[model samples]
Target: MSATAAISVRGLEKSYKGSRQARSPVLKGVDFEVARGSIFALLGSNGAGKTTAVRILSTLLKPDAGTALVEGASVVEEAQRVREAISLTGQFAAVDEILTGRENLVLVAKLRHLPSPGDIADGLLERFDLVEAGGRKVATYSGGMRRRLDIAMSLIGSPSVIFLDEPTTGLDPEARLEVWKVVKELTEQGTTVLLTTQYLEEAEQLADRIAILHGGTIIANGTLAELKALLPPAKVEYVEKQPSLEEIFLSLTGSTKQGDHS
Candidate 1:
């Protein structure tokens, strides 16, 4: 593992017992490294073992074979230490519907045994741009706001690494963009993020490095430009440009819809 890598996996493997006498392999010798204070995206389709890998790295599941280290601590041997260093926000929002945004954060802080939970919750509310909505019940919050509060709860422990499993799933375009901004700010402030996303554009927009997983293994790993370079060169041709429907509509209406108009 690289000394500077915040999260490191080597020869990782996992298998689950099936109905028959055979076992189904989920992660087959998966390997990757995430640098400190940078975004690393695991790009794959459903059943590509993206979530399984996240579960292992976050100490929710044990790998049948291989080693994973978070901030130089072994996930298997130092599970508690690893837990202390990481937070995970799953595909769905985990906020309490009956609790206000501020209350939810404070509750997490209290669970983590942090001092000054109220102050911590207040700071997170402002950090996630939910100050005005902090006092409102989570049930009344928008999808974007709920997602923001969910992430805010994860930060209550001051984790060094965060696992975002398909973080933008089920979010509107505007809401997805909002979450993207929050992720960008986290890396800027020296927090390492490991994101699993099926959205190629999301990886292109956010990942400092990307690993494409297939059949439980990393088939390709590199920056966006590097990955593009691996593909055969495209043929160049000159043709008359045509305006897209979005451009045509914008030109006609002079404005765009606020959310998913489709």
Candidate 2:
């Protein structure tokens, strides 16, 4: 493992046993390194083994072959230590629906045995922009607010790395942007984030490094500019620009809102 790497993997392979003679291979000889305090995105379509890779790295599953290390600790041999150093948020929001946002955070903080759990919860609620909704039940919060609270709960332990698996899957465009801002804030605070998403724009917007996983392997890995360079140069064409559907919707809505306010 490199000294500068927060996470490292080499020759990682995993397969699931199916019927007597059948086996389903997910990850095949996967290798990658994540630099400390940077966002690394694993971009892939459904069934591309992105979630499998995350599960293995987060110590929820063991690799059939090869090695993975989290902050110099072996994920296989030192899973407990690895778990202590990382937090994972899955595809769906994990906050308790019956609990208020503040209660949800306080629950996690207490579980982590942090001193002054209430103070930690209050701080995170403020940091995640949930202060206004802190006393509202999670069921009453918007999808974006619940997602933000989920991430804030994960931070109670102050882990060095966080794994987000398709976090914005069901969110609207505005909600997606809200999650993006949270991700940016995390990286700015020196947290290493590994997020898996099928959205090309999501990776382009947030990832410092991107790995494109295809057919159970990494087909390309580099900065966005470097990956773009691998493609043929674009041929310039002269054409009239037209507004997209999203732009049209926003424009129409803006006009309606202004008229109502007037």
Candidate 3:
């Protein structure tokens, strides 16, 4: 375990027992580290074990083999400490539609046994730009507002690390941008974020460091500039051939799906 890393993993492996004891392996010796206060993205398509990795780091699931540490605490050995040091927002907004947005924040604060839950809720509501909607039921809020509330709830205990598993999965373009802004603001406030996403642009726009997860293992890991350097210089012919954003993304992730390169 590295003392300075906010999150670290080494030779991690996991397998699930499916249908009559049939084994399905997800992660195979996966390893990566997230720096404190930085946005580290695990970029992979669906079924690439992004969620599985987040689960293990957040102490919600155990790894069958290998070691992972969160905030310098062993996720396996210090599960309770890890749990206390982190917050997780799943693919969907986990807000209670029946409750008012302010109520949801206050509920989480109370569950955490914090003093002055109402004050905490009010501060969060203002910080997340939800003060106007705080009194309304969450069901009436827009997708972006609900997502903002979901993230604000995660900040209740001021955890050292946050695991966002595809935080913008079903959001529209405008909503996605809103979430992106929030993510950036979290890092600015010294909160380390481990974001898992299949959206190439999401990683490109937000992550200070990007790790390409393919087949449950990291195939490429570096700063954006370093990863971009993996490609050769663009060819200049009679007419220069420029690759599309999709082409660059697929190529970087070690994918073999490029239709009609010609």
Q: Which predicted model would earn the best TM-score?
A: 3
| lDDT by residue for model 3 (1-262), tens | 6678899999999989999899889999998999999999998877888889999998889999999989888999999999999999999999999999999999999999999999999999999999999999999999989999999999999998999999998899999999999999999999999999888788889999999877778888988777776777668988866554345668866577632210
Cα shift from native, residue 176, model 1 (Å): 0.5
- Per candidate, the number of residue pairs that clash is 0, 0, 0
Model 1 residue pairs with clashes: none
- The global Cα lDDT (0 to 1) of model 1 is 0.87
Give the runs in model 3 whose Cα sits over 4 Å from its true position: 236-245, 252-262
Let me know the TM-score candidate 3 reaches against the reference structure: 0.93
Compare the candidates by lDDT and give the number of the best one.
3
- Candidate 1 stretches with Cα past 4 Å from truth are 239-262
All-Cα superposition RMSD per candidate: 7.6, 8.6, 3.3
Quickly count the clashes in candidate 2: 0
Q: Please provide, for model 1 over 1-262, each residue's C-alpha lDDT reduced to its tens digit, 9 standing for 90 to 100.
A: 8999999999999999999959999999999999999999997766778999999999999999999999999999999999989999999999999999999999998888889999999999999999999999999998888999999999887899999999989999999999999999999999999999877678888999988877788877887666765544545568534433223223333345312211
Ranking of candidates on TM-score, top first: 3, 1, 2
After aligning candidate 3 to the native by TM-score, how far in Å is the CA of 233 from where it should be? 1.4
Error of 1 at 246 (Å): 21
